[model samples]
Target: MTWDLLLSGGDADIAISGGRIAAIGPGLPRDAREIADVSGCLVTPGLIDLHTHVGPGYWGIDPDPIAWCSGVTTWVDAGSAGAYTVAGLRRVAETAAVRVHALLNISAVGLAGRTGESRDLANCDVALAIDAVQANRDLFHGIKVRIDAETVGANGVEPLRRGLEAAQACGVPVMVHIGTAPPSLDEVLDLLRPGDLMTHCASGIAAPLGPSVRAAAERGVLLDLGHGSGGFAFDVLERQLDAGLLPTTVSTDLHARSLHGPVFDLPTTMAKLLAVGVPLDGVVEAVTTHPARALGLSCGLAVGAPADIAVFDVRKEPFTVVDAHRQTRVSPIRLVNRATYVAGRLLPPRLPAPPAPWIPLTGAQRSALDHRTRAIRDLLTTPLVGVDGLAEQFPRRSK
Candidate 1:
């Protein structure tokens, strides 16, 4: 499937050796020592997350353990540090358990806090950014700029301009985060080239799905679904998808705070897109093939492409999913990952964590929580007898 042609579906098996896919067919000799049965699960290339802050930032998290648990082989930390601080970021990435890459922040301080990185235009040193990219070309693949209300309060599109300058100077791509606009989405789209990426596409929308987005998309300006804390609004995504415009790649703009709410994990984000009416195949491709292409990484199920693979169970169940705007939707399918292999090395998925403890609650809050818990416990003790019991415990929303 990596090549221009499609794969023929039949009973098939894949073999790996020396950290590369060796053969794929039936009746292949057991070249390796181990074999396991993986029936009734969909397999694809290892997922490449294009946007994250898993480095040493305020919202950063250690990526490798999470990556292994989530079937993510390649994790891109988006703009956690800037030109002056990227050396430290590189040092951290070098010791990571997964394949780690980063985008050089246009601002010199780079997302140290929520505000003031681009408030002063002097903070964006194009020369220093280019120098950093050149110095760490192996680790830094692109440039990152946040064009939101906080990052660019009065500076307008100057931060983006410097980001573009740095990208052009270093001959790499630019990943722009869209937030509240003073320069406007139209102006931002005008500057981006074909290979450049516009993240947070499902964020706040000021207008309908009109010609501006279409024009940029036609010019090959890729859109990215970076579902951060409040970056993805269901209405915005539905409106855009209704216009037949979908993101080229999907990413979980995962940080520390967002992990607890609206954006739980990458699998939840993928399930959200599937519930929003995107095809399941397209959803998997967005995380695998599309992101690999966007980030210039090699990934596939073919021989010698890479031995990385991910296996998941496509569960069919009724679940209530929520978006960043707190709107709930029903998903008929959930993608639960089971395992990931990095360069022919196997990594198994772990069990999901238990529910959060009520330790951080106030005295009144704890009392209320205990009361609710006991009420639910009482209902459970007498449940499943009849419609009356079910209705009393799980009442439908009042129409």
Candidate 2:
């Protein structure tokens, strides 16, 4: 049978038809309707951002399709929605061009802080989370708990314990946000089962899992690099990586604040990992198969699965990748998104636009927020060029 699309490179030829891969081999059918000659590109399963806050940023009505544009065919909204807000997320998920899923926040208010964070320990209502999970069983894959010291406050492990309880009851995995206080990383890891996910695996200044993190990985608990600017630490990551404690999945803990710098999208994250010695296949697995497995979604590019593909330029170019903590590495090799296809439909290229309302600071304003208001004045002066000059945009202060 003729395929709808064929992407060949690296001894892999993925033939797609009816939204699933019909064949993966060297020879191609000559009568295919469309052909993408991705010879110079790295042909891999469409990327998946297993964690993100793309929803609630654009209007709480639609998920930002940046992932789709960046060769991410599917994404799992990490914990942008809790019981109170999941309904809206469901709406957004439906409208998204990419296949979207969720690890519903255990907090009833969901990600309510910037939009809002449900600080009330009372808001960690397991019943509500379970109810939401059941209601959106197709979209809501599991549960999410932000076990940060600031987010959890004095509630300690009580919220985490409840989140685990809900996850257990639902027979689904839990994706926990680590790097917080109250319950140490060990305590949080101890609470997780084999299939559960740990976002921000290398986060804050100090993260959980080094030797212990390796043990957890060996035991089947998945570590994810949900690098959200401040959520990643190079030294800590290096220690973990050197200890053979690598992440099973790679994700951008992307959101309004961390989208521009430090987190340039999934491809940049993959490039940074490659620069750090992660093999291309390993990196691809982390972003593709491993993430899909974590999210319990199909990504095999096999027959019946979605016909999603991400082509990247694995070229040797002078590239500087940064993490949340201003750690920069200048490397000559980088991976860049060439194109993305969803169900055999190709996505177009997009140029970066002015900072959206959700992100009030331009790249320069972020660097100058602590200095003078000169950057803001510059933005006013140059409305045409806009604030893209601020390569280090910071979070806007609370009004």
lDDT of 2 at 328: 77
Q: How many backbone clashes does candidate 1 have?
A: 0
- Indicate the residue-level lDDT of 143 in model 1: 96
Candidate 1 clash pair list: none
Off by over 4 Å in 1: 1-11, 205-208, 348-399
TM-score to native of every candidate shown: 0.83, 0.85
lDDT of 2 by residue, 1-399 (tens): 777777765456778888777777676665578776777777777888898775563412233447545788887888888888877787777876778888888888877555225457778888888888988899888888888777776777778789899999898998888865666777777778899888888886446754667668888999889898578877777878888788889898877667766786888888778767788789889988888887678786666667788777778887888888888776567777777888877866433344556665666756755343566557568756547755646877888
TM-score of 1: 0.83
Measured with C-alpha atoms, the lDDT of residue 151 in candidate 1 is 76
| Tens digit of per-residue lDDT, candidate 1, span 1-399 | 122221122245677776777777775654446664556777788888899887675767677656666788888988998987886787778886578888988998887776668898888999989989998888889999988777788888899999999999988889998877676888888899988998998886433255887898899989999988778888888989988889899999987656656676788888888888899889889998998888788778897777787777778997678887788888788877777788877764333222234213346545765776788678779845776545466778998
Worst lDDT 10-window in candidate 2: 56-65
> Candidate 1: lDDT of 22?
74
